[model samples]
Target: MPYLMRAEPYDASIGAVRPLFFSDLGFTSEPADSPSNTYFVRRIETPLAVRRSLFSGSAIGGYSETSFGSATLANDDGKLDWLSDLDWDGRLVEILYSPQERPALADFTVLFSGAAEQLVPGDEIEIQLRDLLVLLDVPASRGQFGGTGGVDGTAELRGRDKPWLIGRRRQIEPVLINAANNVYMVDPAGFSSLLAARDMGVTYPAAVGDFASYTALVAASLTGTNVATSKTAGLIRLGQKPNGRFTIDAEGVKVSGAWVYRFADLVRHVVTSMTTVTGASLLDVSFAAFNGLQPAVLGYWCDGSSVPKVRDVIDQLADSVGAYWGFGEDRLLSLGRYDGPAATADFEFTERTIIDLTPRPVDRRMKALKLGYRPFGVIFTADELDRVNVSAADLEAFQNEYRWTAVATNAAAAGASLLATEEEGKTLFDTEVAATAERDRRLSLFSAKRKAFDVVVPLTPGLTVGHTVKLTDSRFGLSGGWRGLVLEIERDANDETLKMTVQG
Candidate 1:
């Protein structure tokens, strides 16, 4: 006997609570002028694809194998089709309840039986079920529309299925034209037409009679456009003044005072080449005339209050564009303090003169050191040698004792012969006697030669005053000692000398 059991409620906060489905949300409105009759409704659609479970079960009846010659068993397959359509009724719940604000949806959970006791006898279950629905709401203000600025209006609401309709109608406004109070009353179309006509070379018309003549003259001076009222009177007039004067109310006004008249004079006198008369040329002429006018006139027009009244008119004329008239391109006219035909006086010639008498001569054999070349030795003559008390023997001794030669091949032979023949046979007394006799003979010959020939020795070529040259091969005294210069180069009447002024 089985006892009955009751099913208990599960916590909705857990995963077991079920969810509800929502179908649509939107708005409707009526026209303001015909609120009772005019109606409009907007539809929003939501379609959700249902999901299927992946698992199924099958059952089979048991049979005896001994009686089984040709018997077959049937199979039973069961699936949970009911779980696929599990409806969710409380899927979307509004939390904020403001009348003007749009509704907000809350989240939900599934609810189901947990134990097997919840099922009836012989019942089979294969899958679990759950659901969720999309939620949408229309704001109360947009759902019902009225008028703006007394014009009837209507709008349709939409939901999640048609999101483009939200807040779109409120974003439009009308544009107004010519609404400012300070605008002028001139006809825009007529002003544009006048500008077009002017661009097409049409001139403004003048009034009648003398007033028209005066106005036309003034306008002609300002801009080079002529306007005559009557077709019979030509707009342009040309004539030559033989008397160069016009009787105007018994007063004389120079025609040069008027820029237009002066410009005409310039056109005739200077700018004869109409082919070269361009806008820039006309502007240059106008600026020149304007600058050349009286300072009061110039100051009144150009606001140069600081310029002097008695400014030089020729200075202004020299600055003008056509001031070079009648002058060749190479010839320029001066107008300031330096003005005159440029002087062409010839350069004068005084007598071709020379000053400071002195002597200069050329002699190639003088042995004077030329400029930029250094001399190996300087020579002094005999008269100059007397300034220093050096005798001729002193210089000859230096030259002979300091003269050098490469070691000779026969030097060893000569030395051997001398030592063997002379040195081997000598007693001390005989050697001394022979050396003294030879020395006496040399002294006597040197003294006689010094007196008879006045033999002056040449200066050591590489030695200079106060400088020394080494004597490595001395015939007498120690070798490798230095010889010194005693005097500088000088010339006597007949010979050159470097006297032995000192010895080292």
Candidate 2:
């Protein structure tokens, strides 16, 4: 197998990105051209190698540890001296492999592709690459406001027309009314008291994109009264009326406007709007897989104090609905529901291919995990019946109200505990029925055991994380095949070994 490497560096002289190709086929000899499938690349003798680490965790809310590793190239002939004049940051670098024995193959398998972060020139050139997901790290505001010219979320949108919040969304109380602009500068922190009052039964004030009127003075005065038992029920009812300038909806309130986005649409907005380090725009993000999952209505409030990152919005949306997300080999964002394994195995690793395999069972057990949304201060505990369990000492919190079910269900699926974790401080679910449905979903996926493994095998070309692998190991058991979801993959040019973490 011969490896082909391609690097695209921005050439200031040409005022455009220039692509350079290198190969490991010719050493200590003159450069020669060799065909790799349909494309012919230059083969040079100098040392060239790459190490890549990729993670596409199969579980919703699962964390991925990403490192694209480094690529070292030979520069002994000074033929690569021109690289010093080019910008390395955000340039494209890719590795492709083709087996000579498999000449029938028409294309080289793209082993890795990412943005080159740095270049250290010497006899050997070392280029550091970073995952493309880093593109979404930009601040999540539609536009900046107050201090300087900011993003205007209402500006004509590109791609899909789904409206998204310019900043954070909260259960706001109008502290100041800009009667001149018909805008309400809200006190986002004021609603906690009303939500914490169990008797208030705080209703979603109005339809989305509509403003509800209220007064800060009236809300503050009613805070101390017991709306459930006080004979002054009439006075307590005054707090829920709309006499303020705040825009209100079932999701929350925004200062100047409302953006009630569907779960999938919000995810797409953050993804498509981001610009990658390579100056590549992700305007073509694929959402066909995303729209197939369970849909929910989600929104947020944006203020000077609370600007979100694009990655954060995607994660929050995915985690809220038991979905997983990652960039695919196509370099586009992909999302899927974490309900179960893929319907069919992508490939099989049996005795013929597997070198070694070992089971790694999680031992940590939990008695209870408590979580709460910050806004409503409603707390719920998910308890697991086990022989040994730990207490809910670490309290988890979320920004949105309706994420308890997703969190709990995903926790249970991850083998953290047989029961889903609970939130205690904030209530994301507004109705008992909704809360119960979330709890039931968590219960259905609960399990006392989690199956995971570390597998060692020869280089598996075209293998990507999140793909299913059917394993058959006669050494451990019968010849029956077992399906497992690929979570993480590690491989280097120094060896043919591919290390993977597989969960079933």
Residue 482 in model 1: lDDT: 29
How do the residues 472-494 of candidate 1 rate in per-residue lDDT, one tens digit apiece?
Answer: 22323414432322222111101
lDDT of 2 by residue, 1-504 (tens): 677677889999999998777776621212343433334234333322333333233333423334467777778777777788899887788776665644332446777777787888877778877756666667764343232111111222222111233222334332222222222332221111122211112333221121222332223333222121111110112233332222222233222233324455556545544443231333233354455444334444443345567777666555444555665556655655544357689988888889889887643333333333323222223321111222233222212243342334344444555443433323333334444453444345433344678888887777767678888987545278777777677765557668887776
Residue 386 Cα positional deviation in candidate 2, in Å, after optimal superposition = 46
TM for every model, in the order presented, reads: 0.12, 0.66
RMSD of 1: 58.5
- How many Å off is the CA of 175 in candidate 1? 64
Off by over 4 Å in 1: 1-259, 262-265, 268-276, 279-290, 293-504
Q: Pick the candidate with the highest TM-score.
A: 2
Query: How far in Å is the alpha carbon of 81 misplaced in model 1?
Result: 99
lDDT per model vs. reference: 0.19, 0.48
